[model samples]
Target: MNKIRIGVLSTARIGRTKVIPGMQRAKRCEVTAICSRNEEAARRAAEELNIPKAYGSYAKLLADPDIDAVYIPLPNHLHVEWTLKAMAKGKHVLCEKPMGLNDGEVNRLINATALDPGVKVMEAFMYRFHPQWVETKRLVDQGAIGKPTSIQSFFSYFNADPDNIRNKADMGGGGLMDIGCYQVSLSRLLFNAQPRRAFGWMDKDPEFGTDRTFSGMLDFGGRLSTFTCSTQLAPYQRVNVLGEKGRIEIIIPFNAPPDAPTEILLQQNGETRTITFDACDQYTLQADAFAEAVLEDKPVPISIMDTFANQHTVDALFKSAQSDHWENC
Candidate 1:
């Protein structure tokens, strides 16, 4: 197929506002169908997004032979279950991150993928596909940053709504699972290695029983990464990658605006330069990249094994927070 015929698993806000629109812009993707448990909701979204098909239940969407792949934007807890089901029906999957609740859940998905070798499964970390990040990785690898040693990131937003999925612990809600996973993923991406150990501190919401504020440190042997994420705080996000001779700072790391230009700062030898990237949707890039991989039978940009490692580190950080000590990743 010239373009991968895609099906979206839900009418989730992220899918409706960001991922679906972005995928619609991709040349290699055709968002053919959308489904939600509520038939009316599915119809409304399908009409709004101009999708050709709508289904009240996920099973109906999965059974459609025309859909070459499925994008799962369900809550954290439902990610692995629906992803596995889609794969079982011979549909490729692009799942939203923190792909599983814990390492064991991630492992189960991993083993399932191994059994279904023909299918492609990838965790959606769209920020990695942004041009600014693409440029940052290039600069780091080319010695523009002079052997990166430390990475720091902060992501936060104020959301106290008890009804929101992100505030419900049973649905895998919290600052860490929702936003902190980006920090963990990017640290590994930049360091090009797994952390030896992890240390974490968290403040749980009394009523919600979910971590509202969390800070973690990853010891990457010689280098280190630290981050703080919060569900109740002023909204802000930034990432700084430091090296012996230089540093790179991302102004808006996550939730980058697709319609506006992005900027990054590079500092070296008492000089700083602002690198500007034209407005482009990372989601489109990500969708097209995944479509290319599926069409060409090539390995995905981010593997399930990489997802496992990221979750393992997150799991270790959680353990460290509870034990109040360093835990091996």
Candidate 2:
């Protein structure tokens, strides 16, 4: 059995806490290298994770011929620039989401990937790979919810640490880019098309210039989906898909660790049912799925085009928020 030699671009929180660990546990992946801006940090992370190599500069890591792929968990803004650079080096890329700051950036990425046939690029949306969502999609498609009409999603956390990357403005830190993108992307997954329009408002600090909270409505061909996201306030994360006949509700949406079996709350006419499923190791599953795509030459489950459309909606929301009027999404 051959192992996929994987190098991580940064010792960022997600990379350190999840991606690196997930890659280590994946049967198809062999953690080859880890890099960070600080040499000490890189060394420490490499030692702790038991990775073979560590580098101070991203350029050094990318230049290594032994590495077959790179997982990037850089800030939201650097996603495109760095992913393209890695792909240019003939390395497959798994970039952390909110693929880019906007639709134009995603298009730029699409153009870049056109040059690398063998070096495929994927957005790391671990939630999408989880069996809970898969089962929800199945139930919805099977009419577990009759004619899925709406989706209500929420993701929030109190970010008191203003120094965190999620609060940095130039890094494209904001509730929308960090968390709302999940809701928006999930909204697209609920159906097969992009939303026709989006209306939203965001709260931001004058000094920080990053959104603290955001709530919005996405009209996917008039189905009317709504989502709320925040980084500076609240303690909640849930997603509910409502149809005419019933609904499929997830009590815990994101960050469902190893044993978190998301209870699928199904409520129909007069009676309610709850299905407890085996917990999905989303991060590991995500790594395996990407490996399958790379190893077997199969299509990625989540489409890059879909990433483009999600950015389109996000770009439009920023526009609408700026103008205080409904805008094309």
Candidate 3:
């Protein structure tokens, strides 16, 4: 395949505003179609994005023989459903993060993928594709920060609209599901170890039954990772990694803007150094990477197995908060 002919599974805000534009700029992919439950909405999105085709239903989009792959930005609850559907139709899938609500559902998708060995599947953790994170791993591996010891990450934004899908518990709404997942995944990536024990403290909105704010810790043997995520705080994000000899600080860790330069700070041996990176769209990089994997028959950079492990940690954090005790992952 010269370029992956992609179809978007939904006209979600992120799809139209970020991922589609990123796909357009990516070298090995083109978004050929878009789908929405409402025909007018799908038409509007297709027109705005300059996509060649639009379908009123997701099923129709999946059935399009021209679409070699599908980008799913549906709600969290619908992720597993449509991913399985798309894969069953022989289309490779790039589903949004937190692929399933729990381990059982995640396992189902894993099994489904196993039956279709030729199709590539990946969770859309765009940050993992960013050069900033690539440098972070290099610094750790090169021992620029000595033996890594801990990580602290924070992500938050105020959004309390009752009608918003993110505020609905049944739709997989919560601070952890929305943004804390980033912390859980990042800590594991930086440490290169699975956390054995987890603990959490959260405050739920009584009216919504969704966690509005949460703080959690993961014990990776002697090394510890702690994070606080909120859907009701002023918008802010950062990640700090401390080691025996020094520390690294990422100013805009999770949601770095695509059009602006980014940087990370390293402090060691009584001196500090700053590393800078040019602006690049992580979403575009993610699309291109997945396309290359599909075209060249290489394993996806962010494997579904990694997402399974991340969700396992997420489940432990939720269990810990409810039981008020440490839980093993």
Candidate 4:
């Protein structure tokens, strides 16, 4: 097939406003359907996005034989359940980040995929597909920053709405799972290895009973990475990669604007250089990459093993927070 048929599993804001639109623009995939628990909402989103079909329930959408793949933009708690269901139905999956709540959930997915090895599954970490990030990784590998040793990141936004899924702790809602995962994922990416140990500090919101702010450190033997994420703070995000001889700073790392140019600063020998990337949707790149993997019968860009490793690191950080000491990853 020249183009893979994709079905979106929800009317989540991220799907309607970001992922679906980007997938629609991808060359290797077509978003043919969208579904929601509420029939009216499903129909509304389908109509707005010009999708061919809308289903009232997720199972109904998954049952559609026409769909070769499914994108799960569901909440944190629902990720593993729906992904396993999709795999059972012989559908490729592109599930959103923080693939599962903990190591146990991740292991369940790992074991299930082992049984159905043909079905490709990937965690949606779209930032890594952006040209800026691609270039950053290339430069790091080429030793633009000699002997990379440390990374620091900060991501935060103000959201006090109790009704929002992010504030619902039972549903696996929290700043750490929502945004802090990015820090862990990128650290492993740049370090080209997993951290040996992790340490974390968290401040929970009394009303929400969810972590509103979180800070963590990952020790990759001689290298170190630190990050702070918040759900109740001024909107901001930036990442700095420091090496023995140079440093790289990402001005707006995570939520890169699709229409505007993005820039990164590279400093060396008392001079700073700005590297700019043209306007492009990382989501589109990510969708096309996953579609190519599905069409070519190749491994997905971010493997399930990598997803499990990231979750393992996150689990370690949470353990460290509770134990008030370092935890092995």
lDDT: which is higher, 2 or 3? 3
Which whole-number lDDT from 0 to 100 does residue 141 have in model 4?
A: 93
The per-residue C-alpha lDDT of model 3 at residue 36 equals: 96
Candidate 2 Cα outliers beyond 4 Å, as residue runs: none
Ordered by lDDT, highest first, the candidates read 1, 4, 3, 2
Question: Candidate 4 residues 178-282, lDDT tens each?
Answer: 999999999999999999999999999999998999999999999999999999999999999999889999998989989999999999998999999999999
lDDT of candidate 3 over 138-169, digit per residue (tens): 99988998999989989999998998888999
lDDT of each: 0.96, 0.85, 0.94, 0.96
The lowest-lDDT stretch of 10 consecutive residues in candidate 4 is 250-259
What TM-score would every model get versus the actual structure? 0.99, 0.97, 0.99, 0.99
* List of clashing residue pairs for candidate 1: none
Which of the numbered candidates is closest to the native, going by highest lDDT? 1
Evaluated at residue 219, the lDDT of candidate 4 is 97
> Where does candidate 3 have its weakest 10-residue lDDT segment?
108-117
Lowest lDDT 10-residue stretch of candidate 1: 109-118
Decide which is better by lDDT, 2 or 4.
Answer: 4
Better of 1 and 4 by lDDT: 1
Q: Write the per-residue lDDT of candidate 1 for residues 218-291, one digit (tens) a residue.
A: 99998999999999999999999999999999999999999999999999998999999999999999999999
